[model samples]
Target: MAAGPNEPKSRYLQYLEVVTGSLEEKRRYRQYKARVKRLPENYRTAVEALERYLMHFGPADGAGAMSMYEDLADLFEQSVADGTPIRDIFGADPVEFVEAFMANYPAGQYRARERNRFTSAIQRAAGEDTGQDGTDR
Candidate 1:
């Protein structure tokens, strides 16, 4: 039977039951790793690092998630088309790449709370925020 508009799509529903450490989750992880292995080493590293960053700070909404993925994919495709080496593009600095990517989004595109939290986390990581109160010590 075809799913109704209100019903979850099959591809999305497949992940709904994925439990951490479950066989299904492990299978998905393995598949992802195998696919990533086919990319050039430098590109592979950059992609993996970006994945990690997004896992930590990605959007919660479907629209935001889709937009983020599309933007990142476009950036990677454009870089490849320009004949830029991945290592040279990311420059052995995942944080710098992340910062540059984040800069592309205008302020307030994300939820205010999430945006503030992400900004604070980045500031702390950069050693720009020395105190819990958000003031330099």
Candidate 2:
């Protein structure tokens, strides 16, 4: 029996699609890099640092990582379009800005511990943990 075109794709097929899309995105980003080199020194440095931060701490999934890259690229593109100075946009510390951006995603090595702490804080706020056992009953 042949699967129809409308049929849902298998997990493997979906994974392949994501991989292909990510590769395409990476190609586009490489082109973006060439453009970045023409930008003013401060803007170029900030954008490059941001790219590195995304590479290190962005989503683990290829698709998600590509999306993050696209978003960051869009931000830089928009800044260029708006004639915004990189220093004005990112302040005196581009690395700090990148770190702050990364903090929003909760990825990286400490994500699990951070998630657990967030869950515990929420549970505590809800008064769900009456004692150390953490039983609602």
Candidate 3:
């Protein structure tokens, strides 16, 4: 998955790829593990929670994870309402949504290390907000 200009090495993006029915998902999961292992301890916890979320809930875990991801969706909706022309949610364009979600999440220690993520998500959203897709405005 290509990490966009203002995106991070996202666990969410990694998660979405593995959750899909793609045949090579196992290999991706291996790379995903390597990626997870390198994250800071705090981020490791979120990745772990995400794993538990996936393992226990199956493909439907996204339903639950949304509590973790929904605010970002809401943020975009608010932006869209205000003439921000972006249209995306959850795993859709996860690079954009994950950063927004992480930036706003009240829990986790990634706040400091995720500075780039927060800023980039905003810029990406702002870029999409310009009615390029005719969905935001």
Candidate 4:
């Protein structure tokens, strides 16, 4: 996450700072809340529900989480403009919809690391020498 001396800070880095709960982050979060509040009631409720679910189960990384939240806001705002129904947005399965949405934000998923670790551990236990690409050598 460290930036080089000559490199400009990226938006992702800015988001990581937001996760650290800086004053600027607080202001941005408040602005985000205000935007959500201005949405029509149904869209507002849907966003709230999705926010709650995402907060619990979405990206573990601060940058990824904030990015996801920002995207969520953008999505509903556009949907409001397009007159999209809730059912049309998420379809028959809300969990499935959320999972699909989460796929776009992989940085926060600690489970990916765990899955790789588990695979490596099993290979070691089985006395397998894996190549750099993770194939058995």
Candidate 1 has a TM-score of: 0.47
Using alpha carbons, what is the TM-score of model 3? 0.28
Model 3 spans with C-alpha error above 4 angstroms: 1-23, 60-137
Evaluate model 1: give its lDDT: 0.62
lDDT of 2 by residue, 10-92 (tens): 77766875766543456666767777776667767777777777776665554455556656667777898899877787788
Indicate which candidate wins on lDDT. 4
Q: Itemize residue pairs with steric clashes in candidate 3.
A: 85-129, 85-136
Best by TM-score: 4
Q: What total of clashing residue pairs does each candidate reach?
A: 0, 0, 2, 1
User: In candidate 3, what are the lDDT values of residues 53-122, reduced to their tens digit?
Assistant: 4454323333333444333234443554565433333355645544554444343334333654565566
Candidate 2 lDDT (Cα, whole model)? Answer: 0.66
The order of the candidates by lDDT, greatest first, is 4, 2, 1, 3
Candidate 4: lDDT over CA atoms?
A: 0.82
The lDDT for every candidate, in the order shown, is 0.62, 0.66, 0.48, 0.82
Reference-based TM-score of each model? 0.47, 0.50, 0.28, 0.69
